[model samples]
Target chain A: MGSAPHAAAPLLEFHDLTVAYGGKPVLWNVDLTIAEPCLFGVIGPNGAGKSSLLKAALGLVPIVAGSVRFLGLPLDQVRGRIGYVPQRETVDWDFPVNVMDVVLMGTYGRLGWFRRPGRQDRDFARECLDRVGLADLAGRQIGRLSGGQQQRVFLARALAQRAEIYLLDEPMAGVDVRSQEQIFRVLAELEAGGSLVVVVHHDLRTAAEWFDRVALVDRRLVAAGPTAAVLTPENLRRTYAGQLDVLDEIGRAVAARGRTP
Target chain B: MTAPWLSAMTAPNTLVAAGGVAAVGFAAGVVGSLALLRKRPLVGDAAAHATLAGVAGGFLATGRRDLPTLLAGAFVAALAALGVLVLIRRFTRTRDDAATGIVIGVSFGLGIALVSGLPRWGLAGSGGLEQFLLGHAAAITGRDAAVLAGVSLAAVLVVAAAVKEITLVAFDAAFAAAGGWPVDWIDALVAALVAAMVVAGLPAVGAVLVTALVVIPPVAARLWTDRVAAMLMLAGLFGLVAAVVGTLVSATRPGLATGPLVVLSAATIFAVSLVVVPRRRQEGS
Candidate 1:
């Protein structure tokens, strides 16, 4: 009952993806396709490997099996075409760096290493910060920022990448309403720019209204299509009320809510 | 001739040793700040105790009472201990704290065993090796102080050249890796810097707890500043003050050890700073 994807080939594809932590598998036998420039959402319970899927795509986490492609090409060949913003909580805030310095790091992939960040790099960083509404706070230390502000800084760094595809993991996890609105607006603008955007989001209410398409994932791909159809009552019941004692209740609720239909 | 205290401190050779110890403190503060910020404050703790085995090995290998030759052996042993710690981490299921504990306890045991066995083996200068535990800076020659200053200078230079990379990796390893920065190598480089500073500090703080020489000043300086570069400079200044004062105080108490005195002074500084300096306010920028 899903509408056909756009005629154009998928910009990103994951083929028979499987990932494990230690010895046991977390994500298993997953195949996914994203076509055209759209806001694609991945909704799942806490252990559903939504973040792992993104990590496997970026070569950030070890994948036991699977092949991820960008524009039907291997990741390494199209490395410049992608940008990733990992979880905000993943970094130490107490580090001795300001917001602008953190954002400038996003350009390092294109600029390469051992070379100092130049004036052009600063200009690009400034542009990205301004885009995130962080222009006035560029010189401030990141530790001094609120949780929401730190998330915006992470978004600013990703924006600095200037890639055609952006992968964001829980961009709204701890952000305040204003910062969340700021991030969502930026994401909406990216989608409008002919960029393929995928977010591993937990908020079902927002996901329903925000995403044009979403993939409902548990240990496996439970369902996927437009947000409304993917988030059917049956899918919600199976996702939240399913006999998954290993999963957290909040994760289940979030997964159930992220459904569009 | 000056006042009695000034004249006493003016002894030309003593002046040189004090000056050298001050530089050692400066390098320790700089390197220690990096370690502390990286949350690896006690890594030097492992290197510090392991130097005892090296000191004994140095005397046994060269059959010399010369401080440099002994310290050279201690340096090699300390690096080797660090190597062993890495191997343990890679090859075993033991936790890092456990591994650090093993290196600390066993190497120190080996050092004590070797030193105590010296009398039975009729080895010359075995008795004097005990000075390396607490330090005998008074016994260190004018030339030795100059050597210490040279090593300290090299450490400062390394910190200056690699500040950007070191700061990046220390703050966020994953971000550094994502940026295609050599995160692991940068981390290893900082570890190497820490080792160099620990080795340089041995003649001043000695093997038993020279790690404190690196650790204490940075702890003191953290209370006073938020910026990393400023913290480094302040920590170095604190270390220099501690070293000079401790050396002077030890001179007055003839039999007192210089290393412990220096460390105690640094501890006093740390306590005062922690008490006096208010925690910086958090402002979400």
Candidate 2:
């Protein structure tokens, strides 16, 4: 909850991080750090472990080596101050929960187990719903909403969490143009409010325009820093065209056998 | 109402049994709603099928045919089956559906073998072990009904207390885990509650078909509502109605197995709901 000590330590830091699936490494040793609140993007080719970076940082997946620290502390000690929005496709949209119900989940982490959300929580959820331009659809079934609206609902849920940092995975993958703009605007507002917003995005064109800082990853850290500095043609080629053959072959072999490569 | 119908409804023993079955039905629907939302309805089927083995083992180990002892054994077996399912999923490349099928087929087969062998083995007082195969509510005494009702009530309370957490985990496990909620533990809790309801239902619905008591009502209720809370309430109501109807109908017919009657009644309600509810939702939307 406290600000980074003396503003010297990075707000979020990943050191020598490695991740594997079924004992086969997918993400190799990588190191990265974010020192302040900004619109940060993790951009990579498909299957380049972009999503896995977020998952490993949030502890959704195993970290084979190294550590992720938030404000110089372990994730467990600072989880409540962190909000996460997983990929839109990670959940079943047909689940029997309304828009409000899904958004209310953002409050569950802070409310802890067995404690119901109170009037203030409901009001806050409504406020978040309004932020995503879906306040009127609060009672609608999630499945009935369009893809853009569904993605916004997830954003609203993360907003209700009221965290100091946010990690969003593929929030704009299937989103329409207008919804994409709207999502970016809300994320910009979050950053304006002095919260760190880290987005795992796929579109390179949008990444160039949207992010103040970006990290290009292809199984490992290719380049990172200011978007203009790190998103150069050379860095882009290394990230996209320079996919490691050994990693690719091992990944395919592991996937074919349903084991970790 | 007919005279016999009135008498059947008013009879003390029948009323007690009906009340107990109603509790089981309500709890099953409530717990099963979570399981259904989690997209693991068949997990209950595996647990239910495995309960037969436990019932037989309970009788053999405790040398008693009481509801508590048999159900205790049944619960243990149900958990064991779930554990096996988890192991198979974690250790093997077999898909979830195939693993579930393996557990269901193998455990149920072992159960049938044990129950069928009990009588031939000439174990004293093992004559009624086969009752658990298809279920006979007439065999449940008032004491047994009370115990069943107690377990059902407890299960319902557990669901109510943790509805928010359970729903979060079911809907988005990755988000829940990132938020520091113990997703695996919540899932296990839901599974355990389902196992409890399955065992509670064994006296009336039996191992082979008890899963119907848990699954059908929740699926039917889903057709009627978009909200989790409403779906849970409607599912419980639907389950209660089915349990009561099945119990009473089976009471009137002496030789009918309560399991089939209960399942048939639930399926009928599900059919009706499927026909009636979605149309209304479509019109409203």
Candidate 3:
């Protein structure tokens, strides 16, 4: 595995990771490695466990087996260096917090417990909102924003973390074209600034255009490499339609028997 | 001459009780905001109902009717109910709502049975324990009122200190967890705060309806503001008004329990906010 002489450990590594919900594995033993800072994408169809992959890595969900490492260390050791943008629908938009309040959450991890955000944090959060083109709407109630604007607010929040590695789950799923372009551009800039941005996206066409490297997933890792190499017609078929019934049956059996089927 | 009812409202003991109850109301609103935003409003209900068992058990075990001992018992019961709710949700296939309902119904029933049976069994001094069922604020002494006020103040301070952490967890738990915040511990702190508020409220609002003290004001405040800090302040103010007004009004009536009046007062504010605050614009045009 060290044959590539003196290659620094991947920016993130998932070695034989298996994630489950209620004893049912959603992501199978998946070995994925992000060797460098890039705009990476995890593309899959509905129910393909794309989001679960990120959840497992972040310790949001229980991983039945395997380990996740960030910068050659466990997640707990480098949590401050990572940022996460959860799906827009995962939260109640009507929650009584403004756009700035939500974005300021990005700085909470760095501030640690019982510490309020200082002026420096606020300025950085405002700069992040500016990057996402929502500076003018910083005081608006998050629920009052458009779907695209809400998505951008989440992006801005993630950017406020000032993280070296960003993981976004479905940031553009319901976003308008203009907001999608804005989000992609910011992500591209993050990559240029030497931060690894891993996005869980489903749109195939845009996946081809946006990601520098992509992983095709369907309950398991199908193909992973440069976007051009991983999104071939055969890989797409395998990701969207290949061995699904068989995989489902095996997953159920494995869950029932408490072992891989 | 002032009316007899008006004179009753200004009695020294009654005024002291009202002040303490007001503190409880404010604290409940603040802590309850986090629970409401976290979408765990019913957790307070479960904890509130379970407090009855603790109140009765405290008297039974210690043979003392001190406010602190009774409330300490109630806090224990509330935490136990929450623990049972978590266990049921985790170990069994019971849905979240169903689990909460089970804890509420069963624990409250147990509490009611114990409270009722204690007096019938001729347990001396157990007669007044039933006042905790619907709350009788007039029964509170000046020292007990002071204790309630002090605890309420501490709870509010705790919420103030951890406002950012609580708000982050409430708004987006997954993101908070990913950001390496101790999500479970934060959630547990919120729950414990809710339990504390519930216990603090029991002397004024009663076990059966105490959750209202924690829920109604924050919800009403939500209608009037879009910012969390503003909502919290508004909720606290609304709660204080409801508690003070309810206590004073109940003082006027000879046979009134304070819990229903406090809840009704809060509900009235919520109804007014519903009519007064403009509707928020729907997204996406």
DockQ by candidate, in order: 0.29, 0.67, 0.69
Identify the candidate with maximal lDDT. 2
User: What stretches of model 1 exceed 4 Å from their correct place?
Assistant: A1-11, A71-81, A241-261, B1-5, B91-93, B279-285
Q: Rank the candidates by DockQ, best first.
A: 3, 2, 1
Q: Candidate 1, residues B81-137: lDDT per residue as tens digits?
A: 888988999888899999999999999899888877885688756776777888877
Per-prediction TM-score to the true structure, in the order listed: 0.87, 0.95, 0.96
Q: Name model 3 segments beyond 4 Å from true.
A: A1-7, A256-261, B280-285
Better of 1 and 3 by DockQ: 3
* Candidate 1: tens digits of C-alpha lDDT, residues A74-105: 67776776777889888888776789888987
Task: Give per-residue lDDT, candidate 1, residue B25.
Answer: 89
**What is the C-alpha lDDT profile of model 3 across A71-100, one tens digit per residue?**
887898889999888999999888888899
Candidate 2 residue runs with Cα over 4 Å from true position:
A1-7, A244-261, B1-10, B280-285
TM-score of chain A of each: 0.89, 0.92, 0.94
- Model 2 vs. true fold: TM: 0.95
CA lDDT, every model vs. true structure: 0.82, 0.91, 0.90
Interface RMSD of 3: 2.2
Better of 2 and 3 by DockQ: 3
lDDT of 2 at B62: 92
Q: Residue A147 in model 2: shift from native, Å?
A: 1.3
lDDT of 3: 0.90
